[model samples]
Target: MPLFRRRRSATPVPAPGPTPPPPSRRSTEELAAAEAHLSDFARSRPGVEAFIEPRTAVTDTTVVFVAASGEWTRRRVRSPQQAHALARALGVPAYDAGVVGYPQRMREWTRRRAEEDKRRLDGG
Candidate 1:
């Protein structure tokens, strides 16, 4: 004889909401354009490094380049592997943004740019 009896509910559990569609893949032309842009940036900037960002529900995989001056640019790529390959082709070291995070110089540059913009707005 069981000391306690389990109670069962007749109602069924509700289903979860619809899932979001994944980000669309880029066309060949788009990929080429992105590659060209990255190449140009790498060629023009000194001490540039690549940082690969993982794909998310809203965005595809992306690669970011940070130059010595802390100038940066971000562009989407086919995948992390492509990003690393591109970096290698560009002759720059590539790191996982999720692991290493962004460089401090990049933050400093952004802050300086913001300050400059604010000064201009204030007519200084």
Candidate 2:
């Protein structure tokens, strides 16, 4: 089942009024806290680059960090523009993950993880 369900209503939907703030996984405070975390990661991690994943119907835009060794982490940001701005401020280059796709090291890391899981399940 979908995480968010729409309710059936007999009343007609109201016309849009004033613009509303964008929905986010974290509150404003939490997003700001996450920004600090990103900054720390960029400073401590080597060759880290930001990959901005576009938002879909289900979620907000996310910034994924791929280090030189392919280790990665992700956190939700308000939008792609914010992602780019934040990344630049941190002195890192940002790219659209959807457009350029993930780096080869990231893919290799995933493959290694899967292989390790299979080995563990097979008791070898």
Candidate 3:
């Protein structure tokens, strides 16, 4: 007589837990504070050119600044109003990068700056 072995059945897996709620968005005052910080930084930094770009999708908004030698920085803002105010404080023009697009001069400056960095890295 041949002995028969019984196979054990697979256990059912449990469903995933509920997702947590998303973080609350920042208030206008908080956005203003961030703008002020950026504005101050740009003013203190030599040769910085500030620009604002409106966000389309999930991002709130953005303000970007490029220095004379093309080093750059960017931050998310709450609204266009805040961006304009920040630019005014920094004494630099703000534009919608999506609409007006990035300036040709800025692009050229960035390219040249990158080349310079490469040269420095290569010990030229």
- Name the top TM-score candidate: 1
Query: Model 1 — TM-score against the truth?
Result: 0.79
lDDT of candidate model 2 versus the reference: 0.88
Model 2 per-residue lDDT at 87: 92
TM-score of 3: 0.56
Point to the candidate with the largest lDDT.
Answer: 1
Which pairs of residues have clashing backbones in candidate 3? Answer: none
State which candidate, 2 or 3, has the greater lDDT: 2
Q: Candidate 2, which segments miss by more than 4 Å at Cα?
A: 1-22, 117-124
lDDT of 3 by residue, 48-101 (tens): 766777665577678887766566677878667877877777688677777767
Using Cα atoms with residue i matched to residue i, what is each candidate's TM-score against the true structure? 0.79, 0.73, 0.56
Report the error of model 2 at residue 61, Å. 0.7
List model 1 lDDT by residue over 1-124, tens digit each: 7899877879977889998756567789998999999999999999999999998868999999999999999999998999999999889999999999999999999999999999999999
Error of 2 at 92 (Å): 0.6
Each prediction's RMSD over C-alphas, in Å, is: 5.0, 9.5, 9.1
Residue 20 accuracy (lDDT) in model 1: 78
